[model samples]
Target: MILCDIGNTYIHFCDKYRIWKNLPTNIDKKNLQADIYYISVNPENEKKLLKAHKNSYNIAKIIELDTPYEGLGVDRKAACLGIDDGVIVDAGSAITIDIMHAGRHRGGYILPGLASYFRAYKQISPALDKQINFGISLDEIPLDTQTAISFGTLKSIVSCIKETIGGKKAYFTGGDGKFLAKFFEQSIYNEMLVFNGMQLSIERALKKYEEKK
Candidate 1:
């Protein structure tokens, strides 16, 4: 079986052996002949995939998460499903930090991602446009302008996440997940977290179907 997580920019696919991604326009039915279970945040991409694959199932419909947060994105819900007691952090185009305990979502917040911060700085002033130095130390004050900006942005996010977690384990995923996970003492970097959640949802749906039959 194939599991797909369609984002705004890329369509990620995971099979039993490996994972890969393709642009929505680049997807070929010849490469994806197996049954696909998917969750999508991009409606246009979702429609394209649905049209191409007759065996595809949208697992978002089958997933049932215990969260009261209104208009929670399907991707966020999927990332939180696999963790019963931990802070889930997905550091993609946007950073989403969610707290889950006892199989229920307590609350969460969103923050500008690494790229977003860079963009914001660039918009404010061309001189302030600098890429984030992911390796910059948060312990000492920065002297250079680039370091100063990086320190400020990284420190704010790291400190907030640390405080919010309150010593709970953190589960990090997405493009920049590993970079952010390094700041936490108790954290895991799992690239396949959303896929794991999708697999769980698929299994649950299949079991329900069989029971009904």
Candidate 2:
């Protein structure tokens, strides 16, 4: 199956069925034999993806995951797949920390991404906000507001991880993985964490689909 984990900008996956990233407008579906499409995206964005793919004329079967956790963000669930009995920190446009143990998912928190917070403050008061070029020096105490904001954000998440998961194995992913990993006492960063989860989701979905048949 072709498992796709589409984020804000990039689409990550393991295309075992050879589904092209740039799908053609008139694809011969027979050439691509993906058993299922595990889609975990926001509804509006998901619709946009479908429309874009529909333009290609070949539509893979889609399983939009939305329910039980109505306001749940798909990224968190996908991140959870990266670890067993561990905490996941996805630092991107939104800082997401999802905790998972065994095969069950324990919900996590979300904080404004550094950019989001800066943009928000920029709008609130131009004097207080500035362009944040890089991460806070996690090694040293924050000396300025930008660094303070950076430290505060990272600290909040780190505190959350320690408080919630205790000493579970930590796996960090997302664009800001390295920035956050520096402050952590122990953690592993794999940018392809979501892709791993996507594959696992595909496997589970296919198993269930086959059982029903």
Candidate 3:
């Protein structure tokens, strides 16, 4: 089985062996196989992806929810999978901080990711539109404006996570997860989270298919 997590900026996927690879949102549809299970944050992209694979399944079609938590994004649901209760942060094109406690999703906060923040700043101050080393520790503040902006934004994200998680463990994913994990002492970085969740979704889907037989 192939599991895919299509976010706004990138597409993360893994084969049955769990080897992961990612590409930009504009993916080539050629050389693709069937038996794909995917979740997408954008509905339009979701439609295009499904149309590309005739035998693929979107987990959204198999799950049902009542009043509360109904219509939640499948990406968020996939992020929160298999965890008893904690925080799930996906720092991608947009940073998402989701909370799950007592086996219930408590919703989350969305903010501009580090790159998004930098891009917005560049739009206003094009003079500073250069690369900055964002992989520095919080304590090691840089004096240069570019590095300062990068570190400041990273610190702000760390602060947000610290404040929101409030002693709870955090599970971090997405392209930036490993980069951001350095700031957190108690965070677990799992690149395959969405794919892991896909496994669960496929199990549920198979069961439903069997029941209808």
Candidate 4:
């Protein structure tokens, strides 16, 4: 199985073995042999992916996960699928903090990701843009305006997550998840959480198929 988490910035893929790889969302598609399970947040990229798949294979089916949250992305559904109660923090182009309690999604908060924040800061203040880089030590105090922005943004995000989670399990994922994980003592990092959710969805679909027969 090939599971694809197609977001605005990157397309995260995992094969049956659970090896994950990522590519720019705008990249041209290549051929795929296995069954494709995908969750795409970008409509334009989704269209491109579907068109490319149509031209590539005949036997493999493309399955899109059905999300329960009205406006939540499929990747979030995948992250929280097996959990009866927990908080999911995905740090990519944006940071999403979603809660699942007693099988119900309690919604989440969306904020600019670290890189996105830095990029926006630079764009807004091009004079300081060249000086500010997102790669700063978590323990380091801000020595300059650029460092202050980077550290301050990260601390703000971490503080928010800490307050919301309380004592519940937390799952951290996405491009910058590992970095953010350092701030949380209990947060577990799962790069394949979304793929696992896809697999769970497949199992449910299969069970439904069997019941109909």
TM-score of each: 0.92, 0.68, 0.85, 0.83
- Candidate 2 local lDDT, residue 204: 73
Instruction: Show model 3 residue runs off by greater than 4 Å.
Output: 20-31, 63-71, 140-142, 208-213
Full-model lDDT, candidate 4: 0.73
CA-lDDT, candidates in order:
0.89, 0.61, 0.74, 0.73
Prediction RMSDs, each to the true structure: 1.7, 5.6, 2.7, 3.7
Tens digits of per-residue lDDT for model 1 on 137-197? Answer: 9999999989999998999999999999897999999988999999998999999899888
lDDT of each residue in 85-174, candidate 2, tens digit only: 777888877778877777566667777766786777677776767555354555678777766665765666667666765677778887
Specify the poorest-scoring 10-residue window by lDDT in model 3. 62-71
Top candidate on TM-score is: 1
Steric collisions counted per model: 0, 1, 0, 0
Q: Which residue pairs collide in model 1, if any?
A: none
lDDT by residue for model 3 (132-177), tens: 5766667886888877777778788888888998889999988888
Candidate 2: residue 212 lDDT (0-100): 100
TM-score, cand. 1 vs. native = 0.92
Worst 10-residue lDDT window for candidate 4 reads 56-65
* lDDT tens readout by residue for model 4, 1-213: 676777887766677765654454444344366566777787776666676565322111323333455766667767777777889888888989989888778778788887776677778776656443457876778788877876777778888899998999899888889888877888899887777777787787788789999
Over the full model, what C-alpha lDDT does candidate 1 score relative to the true structure?
0.89
Ranking of candidates on TM-score, top first = 1, 3, 4, 2
